[model samples]
Structure formats: C-alpha cells, structure tokens
Target: MNGIILPVDKPAGWTSFDVVAKLRSGLRWRKVGHAGTLDPMATGLLIVLFGECTSSSDEFMDLGKQYRGVVKLGVTTSTDDLDGDIISERPVNWDEVLVRNIVSSFRGEILQRPPAISAIKVNGERSYKIARSGKELSLEPRPVKIHEITVVELSCPFVTIEVTCGKGTYIRSIARDIGELLGCGGSLAKLRRTSIGDYQVEDAWRIEDALRVPEFRGQR
Candidate 1:
C-alpha cells in the first residue's frame, strides 16, 4: 500500500501522538505519524500520515497553518496558554484602538520564544520535562512568519483573533506578546486550528469516524 493522508479534527485533551496511536491500533498499520503537534488544550486539524506517507511528514509540517483563538488579557501563566498555572494578574484597561494597533504590529516576521512547557528539545530532552522538574530553561527566540492576523472581536478581557502563519509560529506566543504590548499579560484562552495549507478542518474526520470508514477499514 502507498499509504494515505488523513486529516483529523483532533479533540482537546488528546495529544497528537494519541491520535496516531488510536489509528494504529484500530487499523493495525505498522507506520503512522502526525505532521504537527497541538497542545492538549487546543483542538483542530491534525494531519495523520500512514505507511509511506509518514515519510512526507516534514513537507506537511512546513505548510502554513490557520487558527482561530481567544486570548485572555490581564493574566500570565507558567505556560503561554490556559493549561499552565497562573503566574500573575493585572488590570485590563485599554481601548480598542490600542488593542488593535498592538495586535496588528505582529504582522510579518518576528522572533518568538517557544513556551517552556513545549515539545522543543533542550539538551536532547523535552523542554517541558525540564520545566516540570522545577528548573528554568532559557529558550531563545526564533524567526517565524506571520502571514496575517485579524482581530475578530474584543470583549473586555477576551480578545479573539484569526491567524495565518508559517511553520513554527505559536499562537500562544502571539497572545503573550500582545498582552505584554498592552501592559497586561495575556494567555491563550481557546484555540482551534482551521487549516493547514489547503487542508481544512471542514474536511477532516473525527477519530471514531476515520477508524470506521469503509475505505480505511478495507485497507486493513
């Protein structure tokens, strides 16, 4: 078999690997992998590759991604998202003009530091492991391309935005930086990946459905 590319609408609370494992078990495929990793708190399009397709994971990962997310202002966290412990709180007193201006400033290329509680490797070990061990790791900022960011709405402490970015761009970091620019810390409250390259969540399968599809079931 040449294998297949399966677009999955990954539910929250499941790691990217969890999706791969489920399919591997259900379909009994020897080789299965996911192109990109989404935080457990996030839900969205996850590209699942099987068999020979697994070899092309890097190509899928390098494609641009789109997301819709909500950022909560006035609070910072150990991680850059709601999954982490709260580190601080501040008053959110800002007008829409200021918020919009600052949010728009993140357009184009920018250096962003990955969250400590992330999959990035530090000294051959996952950075999150180091963080969980009660140690601090200084991660350097790297360049990522932000194609576009639109402020969808602003309701007091919550700011909603739609983002299109290149590989390695973290929306959580964008929220964190925006809050810093607004004089109040911010953390990603909610996130949903909408698309990757031409693949959209609209066409993705829920885990259970994918496992039961006639074509996929027949492949086994």
Candidate 2:
C-alpha cells in the first residue's frame, strides 16, 4: 500500500469529518485521517494522512499554526463564533491606542479558556454536547504561547488579526478574550488557517484538485 501526505485547503461549511469522508471516497482509502480539526465556520490548511502516512500523525501535531481572522466586537455569542446563539451586545468605544494596547497584551504567553462549543472532551462527552443541552460548560483556562500577533486592520466593529501560535491555540477563544479585555463583547467573524508548521496554504490543493491528481485517482 502506498502512503501519501496531502495539504488540503478546507472550505467553510464543511466539517473536518466531511473532509475525511470525501477523501476516503475519492482516494479509496479507508484509513484516511486528518492531523487536526478545523471548525465548519473556519477554512484553511489541513494535513491529510492516508495509509502508512497515518503513522506519522504524532509528528504533525506539534506544528505551529498561522491564521488570519476577523473578530466582531460589541457582540457575544454562545459558541464564541458567528454560528452560535447570541448572548449579548455591548457598546464598543476604543481609540487606536487602546486597541493597540489590548492586542499587545496578548502577544506573548497567555492563559485562555476554550469556548464552550469546542470539541474538548469532559467526562467522556464533548463540551459542545453539554453546551447544546443548555448546560454550562465550565472550561479551565490553559496556557498558550502566541509566537506573534499583529493587528492587520481595525475598523469600528471588525478587527482583522494575523496570528502565529503554538499548536492547540484556539483563535475563537482569542477573539472572545480580546473582547473581554477591551470591555466589549466580541466573537470570531471569519477565520482562515494560512499555514501549519512548514506547510503553507499557498501550496495546498483544493479538495477537487487533489482528487484529480493521478496518484489519488489511481487509488480509487
């Protein structure tokens, strides 16, 4: 059995499981899996493993990730992203200096709480499952290191950010925390993973294009 590693440009509205299912069908590989999960609302680089490539999954887990995203200030949601139920809306009044200070504060090591709608398992069930049931999911804050975080652009309600961070960092949580720090409710509006470790999104294949590659087609 030949093993192959492919970088995928996952599109929004598709779950990570959806990507795996499509790859399994297109590549005819029952053993296919993804190194990390990307939320349905987010799009970006996904390292797909097939056959013997699955053996190397551990090596891929530690890869640093880069993302570009927009956070909508003055609004809070249950899921910490646009897909969830709205929790509250508050007024936002920030000068450029205040925004810069808040962004800078999150630049290095920080403790962040995972969103309630995350896939993190608690007591053998997904946290999101508990959240959907209308139960409070009390997540503990964990330490995460941000390699770099730059405010790309700032508009009144929407702030664009480019982030490079260690593995396991949740960009959605960052948005939520930033909102708290600025005393304005906020949630992620859009997100895209630009890179994972050495794998750049620019070099990744779209799912359709990946399926058309000779080696992949031959497997089917």
Candidate maximizing lDDT? 1
lDDT of 2 by residue, 72-146 (tens): 999999989999889899999877778777887888888889998888899999998998898877799989999
Across residues 1-220, which tens digit of lDDT does each residue of candidate 1 receive? 5688999999999998888899988987888899999888899999999888999999998999999999999999999998899999999987899999998989999999988888889989999899999996878999999999999999999999999999998899999999999899999999999999999999999999988875764254
Winner by TM-score? 1
Q: Note the residue pairs that clash in candidate 1.
A: none
TM-scores, one per candidate: 0.97, 0.96
Candidate 2 has what TM-score? 0.96
Worst 10 residues of 1 by lDDT: 211-220
Give the poorly placed runs of model 2, Cα more than 4 Å off: 217-220
lDDT value for model 2: 0.89
Clashing pairs in 2: none
TM-score of 1: 0.97
